[model samples]
Target: MKMMKNFRNEDGFSLIELLFSITVLSVGLLGIASTIPFGYKAIEQSAKRSTAASLLNEGLEKLKGYQYINLIESNFPDEVYGDIPDFPDFARTYEIRMASDVYSSPIPELKMVTITVFWRVSATNEQRIFAVTYIGQRR
Candidate 1:
């Protein structure tokens, strides 16, 4: 008789238990689904930053190849590219100026080359990254 009673209690999960389990599982799945959009946006932001850094490096490399004086002759133009290019909503610019305040700074012997990469962060806001390097007169 005792064995029969125990068997009756252990037959299977009750209807209330099944409903509770399903409710908990559904909540967990919903929590997971809410994070997907945030993850995708984060990935997008990281890619843009990487491209900006790459553009900065390329600009600096070209500057390294030129005579320090040549770059100072004219103001560098604003570099801009579209989504069709590697970086989306991106514009990069460079400036060659004398890094020092002394009299000799007028010459190109010591120059401060600024490479800046800018991007549209939002509809009304923009962000930029810059690299400053000094090109000394290498005798």
Candidate 2:
């Protein structure tokens, strides 16, 4: 009588090994899936910041385009041009403050102009601010 050969000794992964690999793969996939929403949120916040910066720059340009002679010695609210159109929607409110160096020199100059843009982001009612400064010359 010939003895039966042990054919069960094939070199391959067992059922337990296969199951463990599948479990690990599933966990990794789940971790990746969870991060997707967080990535989207980060992108949204970055966009809001970019919009605020653009709005501030727009305000600065508007101030620069005006007649330089009138701006050289003017003060806050007087030199500010609040009615300029096409402000970005992301900024809920914006303001400009102008300061002059009338006491310093023979030709008083625009010391500084500050532009502030404010906006809210997310459901928690958080706020972000963007500001820029510019100096103008006397025409």
Candidate 3:
């Protein structure tokens, strides 16, 4: 009982301490917020790239349905400034050429096919992705 009479207790934070904590918290929040725009931009670019890759695959699949002899440069359709029906922001094209033109030695039985997808990120920024494959005549 004698010790209790001399005890003084201080609990909870002072105003100055509270203010300092709040300032630190606010700075942390602002630092996290600043990166949000860059994250969004990266997500957008990834989505666009995915779309372009899908278009390239679509072109290749279409080619697979044709006869080997029909895989000629003139046989495949090429689009210029042509927007896909579902993806108007993107345009696609493909080229077919003799494989012999690419290889050092003649390979008359093979044809080289290239598919390209194009889009614009900004008025001054244009982007494209392409894939190549070779089709050979069956023995």
Per-model TM-score versus the true fold: 0.80, 0.66, 0.84
List RMSD in Å for every model shown. 3.7, 5.4, 3.6
The most accurate candidate by lDDT is 3
The TM-score of candidate 1 is: 0.80
Best by TM-score: 3
Order by TM-score, highest first: 3, 1, 2
lDDT comparison, 2 vs 3, better candidate: 3
Query: How well does candidate 2 score on lDDT at residue 137?
Result: 69
Which tens-of-lDDT digit does each residue in 19-83 have in candidate 1? 99999999999999999999999998898889889888888887866775577736467767573
lDDT of 3 by residue, 1-139 (tens): 8667555354678889999999999999999999999999999999999988998899999998999878876776666555477787888887888888878646677888889999879888879999999888888
Q: Give the alpha-carbon lDDT of every model.
A: 0.79, 0.59, 0.85
Error of 1 at 73 (Å): 6.4
Pairs with steric clashes in candidate 3: none
lDDT of 2: 0.59
Question: lDDT score of model 1?
Answer: 0.79
lDDT of candidate 2 over 39-134, digit per residue (tens):
999998888788767776776676666675554323324212234345333443334334443234443454455556655565457555656464
Clash number for every model?
Answer: 0, 0, 0
Candidate 3 off by > 4 Å:
1-9
